[model samples]
Target: MASGLDDVIAAETTLSDVDGANGILVIRGRSLDDLARTARYEDVLALLLGNFLGKETPLIQSELGVARAAVFTHLAAVDATILALTPIEALRALMARLADGEDKAVALQLIAAPAVFTAGLLRLRQGLQPVAPDAGLGHAADMLRMLTGETPNVAQVRALDTYLVTVSDHGLNASTFAARVVASTRAGLTSAVLAALGALKGPLHGGAPGPVLDMLDAIGEGDNAEAWLGAELAGGGRLMGFGHRIYRVRDPRADALKAALAELKLAGQTPGERLALAEATEVAALKLLRLKKPDRRLETNVEFYTALLLEALGLPREAFTCVFAAGRVGGWVAHAREQIDHGRLIRPQSRYIGPAAA
Candidate 1:
C-alpha cells in the first residue's frame, strides 16, 4: 500500500487539474492565472457549481455575502466550546453550528462557515471578543473588518481577494479529498467542510505557510537567507515554502499573489526584502537540488507567495491556515455541490496487509 496514496487515482472528477509537468492548473475550463486575477470568488463558484443547482439564480454573490454577514453574529454558540480547544475543534464546532439544516437556506451556511470560523479563531487566540460581521461591507471587506475590528484600506482588500481567489480551489488535494470522503458518507455539507478543515490543519497542508514566515524570521534579514537555507538543508530540513506536490515548474498562483502583494505595499512598510531574498534562495536551492536529487523535480509552490502576502496583510502566523480556509470555502461549497449532483458514493477499497489472516 502507498501509505500516502502517492500517484493514486482515487476518483473520476469534472473539477480542476494539476499539471505539474506543464505547470498549469485548469479549474472548470479557465486557467488559474486567468481566474485568480479576473473572476471573483462567487463567479468561480457559479462556474464550478454548474448544472448541480438547476436554473441558476441571480444575486448568489450578494446572497452569500449577506448570508456571510448574518452567520457571523451567531458564532457565539460555538465560541465558548472551542475557544479552549484546538483550532480544528473550534472549526468543527463552527461547522456544526452552520450545518444544522438541509433547507435551501442552508446555502447561506456555505458563506458563513469560513468567515465565522476564521474570525472566531482569531478572536479566541488573541484573548479578545469576536466581533460580528458588518452587513454593509462586502464578504472580503467584512472578513477583514471582523478579524481586525477595523476596516482595511482598498489595497489591503484587493490583496486579500487576490490571495483568496488564488487558493479558492486546486483540484483534489488532501483537504479536498478529505472533504469528498466525508461527503461520500452522505454527511451534511457542514460535516464535510469540517473534515476538510481538520485535514487542512495538519502541517503538510495549508498550515505550512505559517512556519514559512517563522523560517523567514529565524533567517532574520536578507543577509542570512542563503547561509540559513543551506544549513537547514544540510540538516535535512525541508524548506517550508519552496516545494509542492504538484506544479513542478512554478505555481501560477504564486505569481498572481506576489504581484498583488507588490501592488499593495503600504507607506513605511519596512520594505520586506524577504521576497527578493526568497527568490534568490529558491534559485540557489533549485540549482543545488537539481545537482543533488537529479531524479526529483522540485519547484516553487503557492505557499511561498501565500506566506509573503499574508505577512504583508498584517495577519499573524497562527491565522494563516484559517485565512487559507476563508479563501478555500468557495471551492469547498462548489465541490460538495458538484459531487452531490454528478458523483456517487466515494467508496474505495484498500488491500490490507497488516496482521493478515489473523
Candidate 2:
C-alpha cells in the first residue's frame, strides 16, 4: 500500500488535469490561461456542468441567479453566534441548512450556496445588511455587490471573474477528493460540498493566502524584502505563498493571478506600492530559496497573488478561504457528479502491525 496514496491513481476523470512536472492546469480541455483570460465564471460553471445538466449557458446563469437568491433565505435561520464565527465557519454553518438532493436544480443551489453564504456572512459580520442577488449581474459581480452593498466597477468584476475561473477546478485536490469521497457513497451534493468545505478549512489546504498578506504586511517595503525573508528563513520559518505540493516549477495559477493583479494595478484598482512590494518579496524569496535549498525547486505559487488579487477586490483576509470555496465549489460539484456517475465507494485497507488478534 502506498502511504498517502503517493503514485496512486484512485479514479479516472475527464474534468481537469494537473500536469505537475509541467505546471499546467487544464479544465474541461482548455488551458487555465485561456479560461482565466477569456471566460466568465458563469461560462466556466456552465462548461463544467453542461455534460451532466445538458443546459444552455443562459439557462444555467438564470437558474444560478435564482439559486443564489433562494440560498439567501437561509441566512434568516443562521444563529447570530454562528455569524460571529470566521467567515468560512459561518459559511459552513449556513450551507448546512440547505436541503440535499441529486437533481439538477439541487446541484445549482449547492453551487450557489458558498458564494451567497460567503458574501452574506461577511456583510452580516460587519453589521451591514446582505444585498440580495441581482439576476442581471454576472456571478462574480453579484458576489461583490452582495458583499459590499455597492455595484463593483468593471475592473473589479474582471479580476474576480479571473480568480473564480482560475481556481474553478484542478485535479482531485484535498477538498475535491473529500467531495468525491462523500459523493461516492451516493450522498447528496450538499453533503459532498460540506465535506469539501471542511477539508478546505484545514491550514495546509486553503489557509495560506491570508498568511501571505500577513507576510507582506510584515515586510512593509520592497527594499526590506530580502533581509526580512532571509531572517525568516534562518529562523526556520516556512515561506507562505512560495511553493506548491504538485508543481515542481512555479504554479500556473500563480501566473494567471499575477497577470490579473497587474491588470488591476494598471487600471488603478489596486495599490501600486503593495503590488511592487509583493513582487519584490516574491523575487527575494525565490532567490533565497534557491540559494538555501538548491535541491528543491520551491517557487511562487497561487497563494501569493491570490492574496493580492483578493485584497485588490476589497475582500478581508478572514474571508479568503471562503472566497476560495466560492470558486472551487464549481469544481466540487462537477467532481461529485463525475464520481457518482462512474465511481465506487472509496474504501481502502490499512496495514496491521499490532500483536495477533486477541
Candidate 3:
C-alpha cells in the first residue's frame, strides 16, 4: 500500500487539477490565475455543479441565493446548547439538521449552508440575532453582509470572492478523499460533506490558517520578526505559513491571495502598517526557513496570505476553517455526485501487516 496514499490517483475528475510540482491549479478547464482575477464564487459553483446538471442548471447565482435563505432558517436551532461548542463544532451541529439526500436541492443546501451557518454563529456569539440573507446578493458578498449585519465594502467583497473561488476545489486532497469515500458508500451529499468537514477540522488540514494569524499576533511587529522566526526554527517549531506539503516552489494560491490583499490595501480597507508588518514577517520567515533547512522546499503557502485577507474581511480567527468550508463545500458536493454516478464503492486492500495469521 502507498503510505498516506502518497502519489495515488484516487479518482478521475473534471473538477480541478492540482499540479504540485509545477505550482499550478486548474479548476474546471480554467487556470486559477484566470479565475482568481474575475470569477465570483457563484461562477465557480456553477462551473463545478454544471458537471452533472449540464444544460439543466439554471442561473445558480439566484438559486444559491435561495439556498442561503433556506439554510438560514436552521439558525433557530443554534441555541445556547450548540453555541457552547467551538465555531466549527457549532456550525457542524447546526448543519447536521440538513436532511441527508443526493438531490439537486440537497446539493445546493450543502453548498450554501457553510456561509449561512458561519454568519449565524458569529452573530449569535456577539449577542446579535441572526440576520436574514438577501436573495439578490452574491454568495461572498451576502456572507459578509450577514456576518457584519451591514453592507459590504466592494474591495473587501472582491477579496473574499477571490478567496472563495481560489479554494473552491482542488484535486482529491484529504478532505476530498474523505468526502469521496463516504460518497462511494452511497452516503448522501450532506453525509459526505460532514465527513469532509470533520477531516478539515484537523489542524494539519483546514486548521492551519487560523494559526497564521496567531503567529503574526505573536510577532506583533516587523522588528521582532527575524528573532521570532529564528527562535521558532531553532527550537524545531515549524513556521506555520512559510511551507507547504506540496509545491516545491511558491504556492500559486499564495500569489493569488497576496494580490487580493494588495487590492484591499489599494482600497484602504486594511491598514497599510499591518500589510507592511506581514510582508516583513514573510520575508524574514522565508529567509530563516532557507537558512535553517536548505534541503527542504519551504516556500510561502496559501495559509499565510489567507489569514491576512480573511482578517481584513473581518472574520474572526476561530472561524477561519468555516470560511474554508464555505468554499470547499462546492467541491465536496460535486465530487460526491461524481462518485455516486460514475464510480464504484471505494474499498482498498490492506497488506495485513499486523499480527497476521494469528
- Provide the TM-score for each candidate, comma-separated: 0.90, 0.98, 0.97
Off by over 4 Å in 1: 1-3, 50-58, 78-81, 100-104, 266-270, 355-358
Writing each residue's lDDT as its tens digit, candidate 1 over 1-358 gives 6668878887667768888878888888889888877766656666666454323434555666667766765666754557777665576666666744323457566655677668767776888888776665666677788888888887777778778778888888888888777776667677778778888888888788888778877887666777787788788888877767876777788788877867766533325576676666666667667766678777777887788888877777777887888878767766766666667888788787689575
Clash pairs, model 2 backbone: none
Candidate 1 residue pairs in backbone clash: none
Give one digit per residue, the lDDT tens place, for model 2 in 1-358: 7667876898899899999899999988899989988999888887888876654777777888899989889888766789768888888888888888777888888888888888888777778877889977788989999988889989899999999999999898999999999999998999999999999999999988999999999999999999999999999999999888789998999999999999998899998999999989999999999999999999899999999999989899989999999999999999999998889999977889889978
Ranking by TM-score: 2, 3, 1
Any idea what lDDT model 2 has? 0.90
Instruction: Show where candidate 3 strays beyond 4 Å.
Output: 53-58, 356-358
| Cα error of candidate 1 at position 116, Å | 2.8
**Tens-digit lDDT string for candidate 3 (87-190):** 99988887899989889889988888999999999989999988899989989889999999899989988999999999988889889999999999987989
Give each model's whole-structure lDDT: 0.73, 0.90, 0.90
* RMSD, candidate 2, Å: 1.1
